[model samples]
Target: MIDLESGYILRPVNPVFIYFSLFCALLLNLLPIGNYGWVPDWLIVCIIFWNIHQHRYIGVTWAFIFGLLMDVHNSDLLGLHAFSYALVAYIAIAWQKRIVALSVASQALHLLPIFLLVALFPLLMHWILSGEIIWWALTGAIQAFIEALLWPLATRILLAPQRRPIDVDHTRPL
Candidate 1:
């Protein structure tokens, strides 16, 4: 019984959806696209989806937790992904209104630069930590391409069900 337009909650947040999103994001992150780096950033895609749909609640904390989990799962330098993801989550929340309102195609187009930055974050972190610029140019390009291509489809999938109205009866009392 949530109002999509106003984002007013008539009931508690759907825990099922929340946890499902989290699990899906984690799985997406774990998918073995390869160590080469052409794989799309599926977790970030999910993060953007939740951040756009549930901005008020899915802020930096969730990002931090997910980022930490990603660090552990990928066995990367701790806090690097977490820091970048937290920043991205914060940005997504800040722009949720504008983002959610845009057409899916537009959203995909907008994600181009954002995904580029996301791709760069890890590379930048590695450089800072190890002082070596990993030559991931090809992988970064491919990832950006995949992310841009998948944005519209992912947004549609996440938002389609939520767009439907749920039945409510004013005569009923909790």
Candidate 2:
């Protein structure tokens, strides 16, 4: 039970939570939701939250690794998602303090551009490789908006284990 007197979590954050969450996100993205104009980037949000709050455990490296995995899963060009994830991680790290200090709504506003760029990375790569513009680029804009809106919910759920209640000890039943 959490002690109200002193705020501390008895259990430390588990790597399993991180890994499992990331894996689950990958699975969710792979679900048959391709028809939706705006599927959220679940893994990216989790990665950024971890890097921002627990940089030592999760950082750009995790982003790159999982991103590559995502690319492979998506069956698109390899390293495309990896490179984009790494870029977003780098940007998130650089602005983490500022972003974290803001309210969730404000955070979305600040992060929208970053997410927009991430969502656009694939489209940009397509243009460079195929020399053809995709009308689907418009969908990326909607995706960015949805991603931003999800920031608060994702942050709360993913970071729950890390936010522990206070710890209190009593020698005799004070």
Candidate 3:
């Protein structure tokens, strides 16, 4: 079983953790499910975590790439998720300092709008490109709510301390 708190690997700052998280996000995205009332946006959750903690390593480019992968996997318009994810990444990076400092509860509150924007962007794009408004707007809204609810838990998991043994010096000559 992978450690949900410390991620799948032992190395704290390893790029592999990011890659693993992204891969898991993609897997979660592709999980087969018949039309659901609300499906949590797993990729966005993962993206937010990495962007908040590893902004220097994972930025807009990484978001774009993973978003494009999502596009290919889901067989949606090529640039739809790509653009939305990149925009979210940009926003997250722009607010990284504030986000990093926020309490988990506050971060969840902040994530509500971010997830709403993520949901809205795709719906708006689909309407514009297909010239048909999807009736699932309500469903998407609910999914955004679910995503927001999941944010604090996800953040706590992602930000958990990596060191297994807290080092302390117990020996001294007095």
Please provide TM-scores, in order, for all candidate models, with all chains considered together.
0.80, 0.83, 0.83
- Per-residue error (Å), model 3, residue 43: 1.2
Per model, state how many residue pairs clash.
Answer: 0, 2, 0
Where model 2 places Cα greater than 4 Å from the true spot, the runs are 1-12, 166-174
Write the residue-wise lDDT of candidate 2 on 1-174 in tens digits: 221223433356688887788788878877877735578888787887777766778889989998998898889899999999999999999998888667778888999998898888899999999999888676887888998999988866876776654454565333
**lDDT value, residue 152 of candidate 1:** 74
Question: Which RMSD values do the candidates have, in order?
Answer: 4.8, 4.4, 5.4
Better of 2 and 3 by lDDT: 2
- lDDT tens digits by residue: candidate 1, 53-138: 77656778888898899889879889978988898888878877776667777777776777777778888878888898888544
List, residue by residue over 1-174, the lDDT tens digit for candidate 3.
Answer: 223333344336668767887788878888997436488879988997788778878899989998898788778889888898999999988887887666777888887888888788877988888899888665777888898888877765664554333454568321
Which parts of model 1 are misplaced by more than 4 Å? Answer: 1-13, 165-174
Instruction: Score each candidate by Cα lDDT.
Output: 0.75, 0.80, 0.77
- In model 3, the clashing pairs are none
